[model samples]
Target: GAGIKSLFGGEITQYVTMMEESRDEALQRAIEHAKDLGANGIIAIRFDSNEISDVMQEILVYGTAVVVEKE
Candidate 1:
């Protein structure tokens, strides 16, 4: 898996995929948390990624939770 990453140039496919997966998971968790708070929507969503260790990465996602009314 790691061997299929990249050897030539710019974007590494495997790393990109990993980051995408991580971000998606974090976003899902954030959404679930907002849902638990009875939020009907989320706004100003933001994401940040950091390599915490040589073999670990962390993805952080946050947003403002809001309730939408059928006014």
Candidate 2:
């Protein structure tokens, strides 16, 4: 899954807020996907983002979903 946000203004605070929100949403979606796949946890997590337009950015989160058992 992915999260997208648009740059609303030139304010640095707004940019930081939007970037964080997008990252968090993307991570949440990734976690949900892992759970749906019956994974006990996710490893090798990675995040990437790209600018779709001058005002738009897209964030993606990916990881290996795995099940672990206690010895």
Candidate 3:
């Protein structure tokens, strides 16, 4: 495994969607977070879920935002 660290979190009003789309949304959020931090890349990314309510849910996206040095 590469050097890894958890980073960023995003939650939206759990819109029911296909699994693949959900993953995309989470990935987008994570990527945006990294971009905000001026990170060149993110590694060791992971996702998680939490039941906010019977009707509402939350998604957490995390990754290691890395400043890649160009040689």
Per-candidate TM-score against the hidden true structure: 0.82, 0.81, 0.63
Candidate 2: list runs displaced more than 4 Å. Answer: 1-11
How well is each residue in 1-71 modelled by candidate 1, as lDDT tens digits? 23334567556777878888888899899989999999978999999878789999898997999999998
* Every candidate's lDDT: 0.84, 0.83, 0.72
Q: In model 1, which regions exceed 4 Å deviation?
A: 1-7
Instruction: Residues 39-64, candidate 3: write the lDDT tens digits.
Output: 98999988887778986556778889
What is the Å distance of residue 65 in model 3 from its true position? 0.5
Candidate 3, superposed: residue stretches over 4 Å from native = 1-19
Instruction: Tell me the TM-score of model 3.
Output: 0.63
